[model samples]
Target: MKASIASLTALLVTSITALRPVFRPRAAAAGPFLTQVDNETWVIGNELWNVTQGRTYGVKLYYKDHDCVGDAVGHYVSYNGAASNLNWTSASIVTEGTIDGSSYIDVKFTATEGDMHWIILSGLAGAYQYFVNHNLPTLGEFRTLWRLDNTTFPNGKTDVRDEALPPLSEYISTLKVQDETWLKPDGSGYITKYDFSSWIRTQTYYGVYGENFGSWYINAGKDYYNGNHLKQELMVHRESATGDAVQLNMIHGTHFQVSATDVFPDGKMWGPWLWYLNDGSKEDAELRAKHEFASWPYAWFEDEAYQTRGSVKGQLVLSDGRPATNAAVFLGDSSPNKTALDQGSDYYYTGYADEQGNFEFKDVRVGTYGLQAWSNGSKIADVTTSFLQNNVKVEKDHLTDLASLEWQVSAKTKLFQVGDFDRYSYGFQYGGSPYEHGVVDKCPADLTFTVGSSRTEDWCMGQSKLGNWTIAFDVPKAAAQCSSSKKNATLLVSLAGYSTGVSSNVYANDVLLGNLTSGGGIGTNYTATLLNDPSLYRSGTAAGEWRYFEFPFDAAVLRPGAANEVRFQVTRNSTWHGFMWDSIVLEW
Candidate 1:
């Protein structure tokens, strides 16, 4: 009996110890341009930038406990991929007053060139470390780099580069360009949302090795604004593979390239700094080109070219077979674009039906998106953002059919989960925000569902861990006019456990849904949901096997017009049994 007791205690201890995650701390709120991650380094803004001429540089930084009340001294370091070799040099700091009404450090520094520069903010106890690159000359045009909530690595390394998802699979497809509507400048309008497929032609070019080792490929379907404030479609056929980078290049003029005087010896040097699309992925692509491929590769751009466009079109027939004109069709998805940037706005794309009940989405990007349509009598019909579900799958070089879109709004609608699809599989996107992710650092297996199974592996993660795990997707818009637009929306999580009960406080947009308990004895043997409570289980039916834990909410729980966030706060009480999260899905 004594030996048996010791063995039991040891098993419990091992299970408890197996669940902690090891990674950088995540921040809350919109990240400032600078975050003093540790006393040693800061995550500097590394957006599409190139310093035209070296001069006095300054930025507002987020520091703890104190504002910029005084000046301090610090050091700057340059990095080589070589972990052991680093060039550390001393630098000076001067304080500028807090801008606006926030507590931040405004540090001013003088530098000649910028190459992923790293610095430590001087302080008494834990002096803060920060990173900034003065390489981009246009200080006023600089966009904030690394979301304030993203990770700040040890050196001035980029979070995206360190964690970026693998390059999108290469694909060849056609881009579809729909019609343009000519409307008056005034409020009252008159025009057409017609399908003019292939109005725009695309060309592809891939460069092999040259004398300068400048091998590159331009696989983008190109276009410019036909008119100011013009909206059109750039469509691609959906690929057999899921989300991928859609390479797009929109240049201003004849200027082929530009440079960073901050990094070059003389002002006469030039580079591809300005030629590429101006967004957050510039320097990241540079680093990837240098290290990963040893050459610059194309990237996915989140935003459509300023005047570029794409559309989802189809006639909605009413119950009586009449055209449902003026009905609203929405395209929503939170999956990352090929460029892997989440601009938030990319989550919702909207279009309206013409008098013929023909609806078209004017501008959309590449990725898997969700769809919802609403008419007069009823509203909020759930649909997948795919070719089969009347949802538009926008790929490059292909045009989404203007007549392929269709939906029927109802009084109360539903969504049934299709388990075999990877659209529901998620660890986290490559180079996604650092705060949310698969527990790859601690539990390697918790990143995704087991092959052909809907539940997580029992040993995946958390013997006794606390915190939140969340997944987000574009929310299908509930009916705007009617109160009974959508009903019976529930989040399903399949879990299994042994000795202990691992539970989480389920939340949809911070509103409490219910407690999801795993590994605990259910009041009844199983649950009855519209979608099968199971996807194919690999384990047994006891406490060690998978059981359904659902978080049911009202139709109103769907947010107004953007991504719907589903978060799980692991607030478990230790019985020291085994527990794991298998599958999570939204079924209405």
Candidate 2:
């Protein structure tokens, strides 16, 4: 019996090995011969090559020793083929080799006939290590080195080289570590404005860095009219003199004056622009960039044209007569009757209130503008109210002191609320880790959340097309109030992200309330959820902006002194149709 069992096991093992595809290893290269196409993508023999179906092709990836550290044992090749429904398949084997005194990772895989075929080489430094150069603006951790087409290559081999980058000193002359306070927003204890401006000008006069330095420019000239020209520069450095990897970005532009009668004409401002420096992750670097961008037209500018700019100051009070502390206030162009909530293409200025609700916009361009303010629900209780004051005038070298702007809440009595109003869905389940895809697939099929008993994890961050989500809650005095008088119920929904062209049908106790259509599509949640590396789609907090809406329904639909269910169902049948809620409040 033992002999027979061993024979059967041997037969099964032989059958599985026979089914596996075999790949031949390529010989070591004599020298580096790969041609560069772009920063990330590269080619082998020629700029273009035709791929033959069912033919095995060899791939070699060369990298510097310091850039990545690991043997090529774990390195493998993968391809996304259109013929295979654009599915990603891994190569059977990987091997280590050397070329011209440099280390190279090698793999072999069969090609398929497809309209779009992307060959991906990865696993250079093992899991969670330095897979690709972080300085470049490449997508995700893995690099897509080649794209297969109907072109032929010599010996059916694909090879690419990663050249050593020059030091940061080569780009900026007299490089010195900036004071830590210069990176702060308050500018307290920082160097003098004149000294900082002089340092910035010296860096700008230096010619643009090379492609190997990961430098790019943004032309703000086309966006803002009225003869306003602004040029921005962004660069990623591998390491500084202190051996710390730092990402540096700077924006410097000339400012012009706008008449008070004009609507601020978007983008007209004055200042010596600021620069951001960080040694954090890519997401942290982006956040720093956003802060520097918003803090434009620095009040300390010594420019002659900027000396005559005025300031706007005011206080914000909520409907409950409480100071709206830490609220975000903005002065935007009033030409098209647009407010801060509109998020128009016109340029806008942003500021925040202090603990006493006193907010001020410094160095405001002499012009007429619209003032808007909204609380992020940090200091005060969450309320679905916004303050807007139009026809605000700011004169040259004058302080425009406006009256206290009061925010009026829509609903009076709030029965219950789900999630916080911080303008993000990070409080709910599957919200913090947005890098994963197929989040909806991993969620419960029928999510019937009980208000008091269910925790935040019970509520998914986004609604899926698979089915409707039900919220169950008990309102004790609902029946008694209905007997005396008919009170309307208001549903306030604050969305952190959403898909456009999709509508959600809301119901109370099986009765129709209203069909809510999403405003704009600012996120790729639907498409990103389908990919293996969903982290590639993540843009941190820049993924989407918060949008607020109110839905009024008949109070009779909600059961009194009993279990009440609010159902939300998407009208569209698509994986991409969804909404990420920041908060949902039921008010009477």
Candidate 3:
């Protein structure tokens, strides 16, 4: 009984010692066991069992973060290639427990099966790494890479191919095969699988040996190529590919001769044959010289060439060469000998005088045109200004001048400005001083008005009654002393009157204190208004600037050169607000 008790105690002690936690290996604490399988890298992070495919092939990753406290637990692959959730399915994992009562972790994996060539299990987002593993095949599974966003190859429609799929078998072997190891029947050479970075370097690398290279296999769709290689072509851009530098094996025996400035350049496009070719030697070039091309004969004066007309410029002037303002101009051709177009039936356009008296025609065809000018909408005269012969017979390569002729417009009478006035007094215009008296202060030369302000004062000389009347400035002349009967003479007046209203019933045009009241307002105390209308006047609340008023008298109104009487009337409401007038000038 003593021996049995000792043995049982020892057995229990041994079991308790084995249950104690063991320290994890230091080497594994830094990282997981790393190895390459089929040119891919596999790593075990905090989440165990991670796999990464290299750049050549699409990546595959694996990760796990599960607690195994009571017993060992991990995922496993069954014989049928399906994975088992429990870790005990495989005994291949090497494991250890933590000393500080933490959970144990382990990772184990094996080769994959089936057509799922690319798979991933990752904890980090957007992180990618490459490796050279011995597990993956040199020639990967053949599949469609990418497709174009445009239509089919040009050549019209009749040359469409039946098969749109790529030759995957041929592509798989060719692409994976290294440049150093060309295709050999024995297949013993080292097959190289490079990523997009290495491929781009290989393409853009133009070295001293004159070896030109480019991406032979693009993501472009198969629809771009017809049965004939003549349909689609590749261009060498950036670095020009000379004829001697062409890579025979770049496109499976296909070669291109192109410069850095080819049509496609670095961008891929599908177009006609000649647009893609850049053969250095004329032996393969198709040249079409301009001199060798056919010519279409036509005559034109290139300068005045009006093709589809909207607006065009034509010049005109009076006979004395002064700028003819307000002259009406017409454009069209009329000659009895010329039968190309009917004189009256041809297209025509009319132009009105601008400030410079020049006219322009719109929507007229390219041809010679006649011009006519009139005054008062009646026929003045028809002078032969140079006819506009637009796009007429001329050398095709040289430009021609069309505006080489001059127009001489003539008129019987010219108008001019005589002595003008803002306001004047007739017989017995009273209640004002000598400034209001009807007489020339100064004729033909210069005249100035002397302004005197009186606040709520009585009427002055030449006036009947007065409230707040300012000294009036007047000028007297007959309308006959002014310009021609065909034109209008103008007198401009600008002044500010007191804003004193004599009676509520008196309109601005009605007589107030024996004289018609023009304008007097209380708003803003200062404003400019036109004095042309007899019904309107400008009055102010206080002293303000001179505001202009112009009155245009036509031939009938002016009595055809009769001198006119003008007067400046000043009256105001409230009797206190007023201003003075000064220095008035006249111009033609």
Q: Against the true structure, what is each candidate's TM-score?
A: 0.23, 0.49, 0.16
For lDDT, candidate 1 versus 2, the one ahead is 2
What ranking emerges by lDDT with the best candidate at the front? 2, 1, 3
- Each model's lDDT comes to 0.30, 0.41, 0.24
Q: Which residue segments of model 2 deviate by more than 4 Å?
A: 1-307, 335-346, 432-445, 501-503, 517-545
Of candidate 2, the 10-residue stretch with the lowest lDDT total is 150-159
Estimate the overall C-alpha local distance difference test score of candidate 2.
0.41
lDDT of 2 by residue, 94-125 (tens): 33334234333332222231111222122211
Pairs that collide in candidate 2 are: 49-151, 50-150, 50-151, 50-152, 51-151
RMSD of every prediction = 26.7, 22.1, 37.5
lDDT of 1 by residue, 9-64 (tens): 23221111122211121232221223322232323321111111112112122233
The candidate with the higher lDDT, 1 or 3, is 1
Off by over 4 Å in 1: 1-308, 318-358, 365-401, 404-588
Q: Tens-digit lDDT track for model 3 on 293-322?
A: 111011111113323233455444556664
